[model samples]
Target chain A: MSLKPKTLVDFSFQALKANKLRSFLTMLGIIIGVASVILMIAIGQGAQAQVMSRVKALGSNVMMVLPGALGRFGAGSEGTAQSLTLEEASAVARLPYVANVAPVVRRAALVTHGANSWTTTITGTTPSITAISSTMSTVEGRFFSPADEKSAAPVAVLGQTVWQNLYPNGSDPVGTTITIKGVPFTVIGLLQSAGASMGGNNQDDFVYVPLKTAQIRLFGITFIGLMEVQAAGQKEVTPVINEVTALLHRLHGLPPGAPNDFTVRNLSQILSTAQDISGMLTLFLAGVAAISLIVGGIGIMNIMLVSVSERTREIGIRMAIGATQRDILNQFLTESIVLSLTGSFIGIVLGVGAAVAVSAFAHFPTPVSSLSIVAAVAFAIFVGVFFGYYPARRAANLNPADALSYE
Target chain B: MSAPLISCQELTKSYPLRGMEIKALNGVDLAIEDGEMTAIMGASGSGKSTLMNVIGCMDRPTGGRYLLDGVDVMSLTKDELAHLRNRKIGFVFQRYNLLPRMSALQNVLLPLVYAGVNAGRAANRALAALEMVGLAALAGNQPNQMSGGQQQRVSIARALINDPQVILADEPTGALDTVSSAEVMTILKELHQTRGVTLVIVTHEADIAAYCERMITMRDGRITGDSIIKGKRGA
Candidate 1:
């Protein structure tokens, strides 16, 4: 006589119900494993997404040329001898693929307005710096005009942080005088807040001044620090970088075999690299979590083995009552699968809830993907079937007489 | 006229223990007709249980042929033997063997479940079987909550659920008190008398054997005597 599917299910449920605590305890391993897997993946992906967004905000189709070679560890330290200059930046700006070039000179200095004082990085660049960074905008007054750079005017634009620090009452700083390194500079405009960028640097914690003013007036400097170059479009970035590299080598009169004194880095490449690293991190974490799932599977196998031995007499009784080997096998296998699936369901709920909670309270991004949920469920089933087979087969293969007479 | 309900020829069974073979059954030939109430009487190691197991198709003989309801039992596969047991033979164990977790009704319906009866009809038949044993009132009670006699009755109900031709009882009352034992025997006798089911009881007790119409005595894995009691007390 063949047992119906519903009857089989009922039998499994009854057996599991017989030892509720044991069943739940056995399921705990799976629940923890699945939840951790989902949580780890969410965290990993969230971090990747955060870094990607921050990198993308750096600007579209842009590259930064620094005064040193790209080191094995990271971006090289600036060379003692300045390798970038305003004339070379203009030459890059003349390239067919080049859209804009901003020669920058940066230094940290004390700025004071009234009794308020703040230490912030002072950036000296042409007005094209505004055109180079799409996210940069003057929220209030005007930016440095060409006349300001030519005249070496003592004028400055306050970043959001500098403005707020100098004027704690939220008063507008535009058209006010603020001293930079004891040199008086009139505030021309207040830039919009750009939040934090990659490397945890506050993008809005700087003061902007004209390049000539910074070079001749604030700190005597002959050569620029870096060049921020924007390409004509997305497709022109690679070509622009290569042309800039060749132009720099020729303009600097370096030998063909000599390593570049200046390093050219693509913003998009950095973005993709960050994505790849975070993606690997996500995979590695998920893999570690998957190991726990396997451990949980082993836990299932252990409990199922114990259950089979404990119920040997029951197996015998069922066999004597005309239960086929297949019937016994199916019954035990179904019990384990039900157990794991139940755990997986609970894990999904807990994992998703935890991700949402973390994102809400901890201010961490944790995006739960449906694909992860589906994959988690599928893996749980596979684990159940794979681990449960041995014990179930052992149950089915028992000698009815021996099992019946087993004490 | 037709073949006996159970037939065995030169039946032999042995087990290997510690590098030596121990014979449980030694070339026994036996047969029983339909509608017979028989008891196999023997001491602890006389192989009465082994014979009962082979006759019930729960085990295979080492060297012999067994036929149940005219079907060759020795040649059947494990699944086919299970199906045969489900359709042609029912078991009543000494401990009642009622799944302790289930209610009486559920226990009684177990055989019908194996028989692939639909839930509605299976339940009806199980209730009828339980009613036959006079435990219908306790149908919803678990075995642990019932008296030994009641649990044995539930097992009898389970055995009878599929309406098999034969019921094999292995010391069905061994775990019960005298009164409970008598109550269980009364139910068995009733089923045998009213339904004409062939009943085989394996027991070491002479009193329990006396309830059967025919008693077969065994010694040393071999049957020594077979006799019909002229006036069986209950039959």
Candidate 2:
């Protein structure tokens, strides 16, 4: 027996060369399935990475102390509520391991800059917030200072979006007054544009001001919403958290045996948990996409089996001309694999297109991973082998006499 | 003759239809020398096709010794038998089993493809075969685009491409018109006479069988008559 290729592309591109359209269509299923898998994972992973970096941007040592640890949706812990105050924020800052502390007080407020008025969110924070949260970058003007917080200054910092919207003209709005709920505050700084959250929320669409000023002027006084503490180093985070909890308990006048009313979260843990959530989300979506692959594989098998029956006489003729079972098997196997691989390649392109379109045009945080692309292509090929095999073997094993005699 | 190129002793083949064992061949013995053109003919269900399959090594005998050119076919492995078929035999089918997707040239080059002949040599040989059958100009056309006679000619070219020792034609002209059938028979006679290749054809028509020098007539599961006619039997 004669064997092996003497041609770059098999000169024996017999069936494929003949039924190009049929072959391409047959392969299309695998392509779509594979592309779906790759595109979904790539975009998913890309988004995951973006969210992860944003979470990490909170700083290596940043810790969040949330009041009233609530499980699931509603039902915040009553009586056990540990309300964080401006003093508590200072106490956390005073921890030996602490570097800077910022009190976060968030509220939805209507803002006005001349005739173009929009109801945007106002994030009440200390000046150190700009330095602590890695996710947000102040764009044009300087952020608030410590003196501004101590003096309870009525000055404000605008994110890129808010600055751009209120100042539609190409003019710097620093030192300009923008009223929040009829209260005038000077725009001392403009923040850098933060991209977007996975939920598609604009990270750079809020207004920032001194926490004390926000409380006294707008929301209320004394009790703060959350204490945003930044550790000097990652190693100091646990100690800082312990010290802050101790300080909160002492301030709350709670005796021993009561459940702690506050919860502290590190940046690393937050980043990992966010990644895990997105990873699980990717897997779930990919699993759904795999159903399409299975469907595609089944379609190939069905088509191939039909092809075998239709080409029974041809198989018989080949066998008569000295082609062995293995040779017949090889030919059919090659056809199926080519079909699946073709589909996989095309599908991957479509998937990537979909992902890129969603991210760039639709503004989503999508993660494109190399591993997902490779896996998708491999899986498409696998679908070909897995599904296309039985029909080929059946064709190879067909009785020559019976096949030849078949009309 | 040194050793008969084809030899068979007590060859038997049975078909299991439903619950019954239908004997397609029962204790058949035959021998064929090299450079012979033989035709086997019978009515439907007369076992002529079964004998053809057995002689072609497409099927194994239930009980018998089949020595093909001194190699015991029964002792040979499945792959070896297939190798023998590819290296030693060529085929022309009644239906002209050209792959519908391929051109006439590709159809002619099929046997050569399995033989692993490079396209250069394979194409040249395929062209030569097509030329021999006067189908050189129709090489690029698909089987469907051509006349039945042309497709059958392409099939003939396919059979001759590998330069096999034996060319087995099973009613090669069965699907062709009277003119095409005559043309196909004429080509078969020339190959046997000029190339000195052993040729075997299975047919139901006496006229088709008469194209060969020798005719073996079968009935049921036995050979009823075997004889050699002068020149070309049909002519």
Candidate 3:
């Protein structure tokens, strides 16, 4: 008997109505697949964003002096801790394109103001360091003046956390004093709370002191811990690092082409490398999630096969009632697609939910990309139609007489 | 000249059973005129059921010419046959094959829906058919809630919904009790008498065949008798 195309809709919708629970469960496969992809991409993207911001937080014109070469996840080393000394920092400041150089002497220290003591780090630097480095700024009160630096005055600048803890009642600490290891250092400034560093160090929990006072009264350092070379302009940063590297080699008495005593780190290179690595990592994660979607598509094919088997008699009846083979194919295919699309929609919602939850509780980066959602849904529908076609074709091609006899 | 509604010449239907062709119909030639209440009776495997399916457009003969309303229906495409089945034939199955999810009214309107009839007109037609079958009151009730006899009647009403040229019944009363079967046969006879619808019944029960104006008997896929039951026309 003849069959019209419209009858396909009727056949499948009726079949779905006949078994609502079974249809919904079939949809679950797509839902899980879609959710996995979205969640994976969101997490990978968030971690990528955090890394970028950390790299950006370092001043664009500043170059760090490190010792030896190391990969991105660098192997830990204690050799040549003073990669560039105070003399190298002074010479860089004297260079034609150099702006200001601050030799960084870092050490963990405990500070006390009225017995409210906090264990934090102290970064030793000259008073001009705030104007030369991206990581230094005065948020409240004043930074240490040149007069305080020349005299090697015992004055300190409090970080955001030290200020909050040592003065919880909001009293101004500019004229007051905080003691660092039984030595009295007047509070001279406060830092603008910088967030975590590229190396994952919390910048807000530390204090800054004059280079002379930190060396004389605290650690007694002549060679600075690390040298920061600030170029006069953004373009001069690379040349400044090169000039400083040359000066440092001469100071260390290292021969030409000898194993370097120090290393110069460019912020741009680090950022680009980080960006490339994170991009690859995101694709890797997304690929892992996509595996589940393939599994889901396979599930759709299996279910359709089982459904065709169970409805053989029904198909026979339809054929006898004047339905054509194409009509039968479309009916079963429509059912499979409906099931997959429903699952995809639910999974998208669940994925967004997981992203929000992770962002809130774990503070892990999770931002929903609209592109991923749309792709997942489209993929699910395609999987439905593509995989479902075979089983539907099998049903349609069956002989009506033979099918009617199927038990 | 008024054409016969169904005409078949040298009609044959065979099935491959265990590597041997089992002949269900063999070169049967016949003509069925309009507005006649007819019954075909036979023992099991006598081809009564097979002939019903072929004439009803549910199956095509392996080799024969079947002309319905002067159209070569046997050679038509599947979709065309479905259209003809919807337009020219209304079927009543022995098991009362009503979709379980639908109410009686919806069941009757099934064919009309595929016919693209508007919902309002389909409902009206469904109601009128149900009323004709004495089932108008149970329109909202599902098939499971109705008795076997009532379900069969609903199936009858459904067949009548599309206003087809013939009402085809295959052992329709075989599943019903005596009283219900009699009532169903009464409706079939009435439909033929009042609406001039051609009626065809496939049954083994002589009691049910007694209600038709003419009876044809078959044995081993061959017609053995054809006789008119006179005076039972309006009885």
Candidate 4:
């Protein structure tokens, strides 16, 4: 019938409307499949974005030297616990690319202020801690001076989380005395809230004290936990790591071919690893969703076969009038494509709605991308053509006389 | 004087039944001139319908040569055959095979659409065809909404929309009552006289055969009789 694409599409719409329920039922599978794929992609993108923000919060030029054989999972400290003492921290600060270093000693402790008591992590470090860590900034009063650290003074800095938990009424905690494990330390400063990290830990849920006071008076531990190192620039982190590794190897007297005792994890490496993980997650989910879409395509094929069988006489009539085999193929293919494209459009709306609902109600971020939407629509068209071809060919190949005479 | 509009030399069609060959048309040799209204009359199983199908390009002859307007029918490709059918020949079925959902005007426009006529001009052409069939006022009526006679008229309009050289009808009034059949026959006669369209009708009724200028009778898949009528009944 001259194979006019638009006219065939119009005919297809009319045919689909002739059996509205069947058309809608055929579209249901595609709707669900597309919606699920879109939702999964949105979740994956949101997680990647959150991870990037969290890593950026740790500062781009910073590296943490943990005192143990820390694996990717962050829990491989079963062997002899490696320690990054203050001496080693100073040794790292002597490296060529080193800018600042802070040797930290952390332990969970119960603190009391008047009648209020709360359990939170207590950090012991030097004034360089503020310089090396991007997450910390004094909003009230001031950080304890290096003089305070040298004198082993009983001065403390309260994190915003600890202040909120202890005070709760917005009362100023500066100049107030708080006892840490029976040792009274007067609050000298307040640290700004840094929110949660990618690992979902509150960065502000801690108090800072002098390293010597924490070591000699509070916990009685001489060893520091870790060293926070900042390079002079972003490009200097790798060189600083190499220098620190060599210096530590020499200090520990490790001979050649000996495995290093500590792990140096840089922010960029972790960020890239996180992106790969999330990207794979998105791909896996999309693959699973595509399987369902294939199944949906099969559903369309089955119904199209049935439609062709039911309309055998109609096909014969069209052939008798003037329609060529290609014309018949185009007509049925157009019908199937119209079905899937319409289903995909509706599915997009439903998918976006579902994603937004999840984000709002569950407080999880979901980012909807235009690329995914466009991909979904293109996939739907492919499914229609891939699955619709066989049935359409069958219809077009029918003998006109037999079809016309068919009951 | 010139080549006939339709010519067949020893045309044959066969079907396989239980590993045995059943010949629907053993051999058919006939010539139909342009502007002639002819009727092929035979009882059931006489292959009259088979000849109509072959002539309408709805089926191909198994063996022999068929020429429609000097063009070799057997040599045309499927798409070319479809184009020939769209441009040179039209058919009217017994059951008035109008698409059940479409209105009469849309049914008439079907051929024009298949012929690649422009959209704006198709409606006017279809309306003219409907007027020719005296169904112009019923242009918006669907097939099911109209009576059997009106549906057949709509189909006739559809066949006429392309203004083909030949119009083929297979027991065109078989499903209609007496009055409706007479009305349909009158329209066919008027079309043949005024438009000079070559008409080929397949029928078993002698009364229906009496309306045409020539009568060709078939029996046992071969022509039994061919005669020119001195006085056609309808005109």
TM-score of chain B of 2: 0.95
Q: What is the CA-based DockQ of model 3?
A: 0.18
Candidate that beats the other on lDDT, 1 or 4, i.e. the better one: 1
The candidate maximizing TM-score is 1
Better of 1 and 3 by DockQ: 1
**Residue-wise C-alpha lDDT for candidate 2, range B90-193, written one tens digit per residue:** 87878888877678997788777777777789889999999999999999998889999888888888888878888888888888889989988988888888
- Full ranking by lDDT: 1, 4, 3, 2
The DockQ-derived docking category for candidate 1 is medium
Top model by DockQ, which number? 1
Predicted candidate 1 versus true structure: per-residue lDDT over B135-209, tens digit per residue: 889999998899888899999999988889999999998999999999999989999999999999999888899
Q: Which one is best on lDDT?
A: 1
The C-alpha stretches of model 2 lying farther than 4 A from their native spots are A1-14, A17-21, A53-60, A66-92, A102-226, A233-263, A365-367, B145-150, B176-180, B207-212, B228-235
* Residue-level error in angstroms, candidate 2, position A13: 5.4
Higher TM-score: candidate 2 or 3? 2
Docking class of 2: acceptable
lDDT for B150 in candidate 4 is 91
Per-candidate DockQ versus the true complex? 0.65, 0.47, 0.18, 0.54
For residue B87, give model 2's deviation from the true position in Å: 1.6
RMSD of each: 4.2, 6.2, 6.6, 4.4
Least well predicted 10-residue stretch by lDDT in candidate 3 chain B: B226-235
Error of 1 at A113 (Å): 12
Q: B-chain TM-score, every candidate?
A: 0.96, 0.95, 0.96, 0.97
Residue-by-residue lDDT tens digits, candidate 1, A6-75: 8888998899999999999999888988998899899998999888877776775999998878778777
